[model samples]
Target: MTIDSDADADRERLRELIDELAVVRGRVTLSSGREADYYIDLRRITLHHEASRLVGRVMLRMLDEAGIGCAAVGGLTMGADPVATAIMHAAGAEDRAVDAFVVRKAQKSYGMGRQVEGPSVEGRRVVVLEDTSTTGGSALTAVEGVRAAGGEVEAVAVLVDRDTGAAEHIRETAGVPYLYAYSKSDFGLE
Candidate 1:
């Protein structure tokens, strides 16, 4: 498949910016109950106005390239929130009209008591997003929630895959394809 040079350039630029602004060297514990010598705090870039816009465009392009015409983009909250929203906005700008949903770690006790919130994904194809994945636990959790809510998980996309068996695990456990926009090595971190 041929990729547009402009889009390729944009992806390269976004990658460089993320490496400069988000990658850090330090000891940190990840949400997946793992420890790492370095960390990729994508929030630094995902929260920035211009960087966020770039992320949205790049991600939308990726989905297009992958031929995943999902009805929605979503994943566990906190991390996936901005990414999904960005993807949704980008898709809308392209007239694709994809919505964004967030999966709560636990269903709310009051009101709707819902786990998946946004547009109803029942019988719709969806893509799960994550900022960074180590064990794929969080992504899989979102997958389970989405499935329980009657959505078909077409794929899972993580901003950064830690290469710690997340992709393999997600596929093996849930039978869903996994793709990462970037990986730890993209930031020069081993």
Candidate 2:
């Protein structure tokens, strides 16, 4: 898919911002129980006002370019909230009108009692999102939840891919497109 020169330039600038503000080097344990010499705290950028806008723009552009039609964008709560909200607002600003949803780690035993909150995803095409991907565990949870709720997972998008084979895992397991805005090497990691 072709991107406009202006959007491409913005993407480059966003990459610089992410590399400068998000990537950190040190021994750390990831959510997937893996040890790494460097960690990517994408929330540092995904939560930033300006950075979030750029992220939304880039991600939405990617969805548009890929020609994937979806009724909504969503994923597990916390990390996916900002990305999905940003995408929803950005799409609204452009008159695209996509909805957003948040998936709970566990179902609440109350009113609605649903695992996914927000608009109904049943029978809808949805894209799962994440702030950062390590082993694809969280994204997989989201994908499974969406499917179990009768939503078709159109794809998975992440702010950063640790290049640890999660993308392949997601594709093999979910049989859906996997996309990321950046990778470990994007921040000069090995």
TM-score for each prediction? 0.95, 0.95
Mind sharing the TM-score for model 2?
0.95
| Collision count of model 2 | 0
Per-residue lDDT tens digits for candidate 2, residues 1-190, read 4559878987898899888998899999988899999988778887897888988888898888888878899899888889998889879888987999999988779997889889999999999999888888889999988888889999999878889999999999999999987788878998
The C-alpha local distance difference test score for the whole of candidate 2 amounts to 0.88
Residue-by-residue lDDT tens digits, candidate 1, 1-190? 3558867887898898888898889999987778999888899988988788888988888877888779999999989999999998888887888999999998899999999999998999999999889999999999999999999999999888899999999999989889888888878888
Report the alpha-carbon TM-score of model 1 versus the true structure. 0.95
lDDT of each: 0.89, 0.88
Best by lDDT: 1
- Please list all clashing residue pairs in model 2, or write none if there are none: none
Give the range where candidate 2 is weakest over 10 consecutive residues by summed lDDT: 1-10
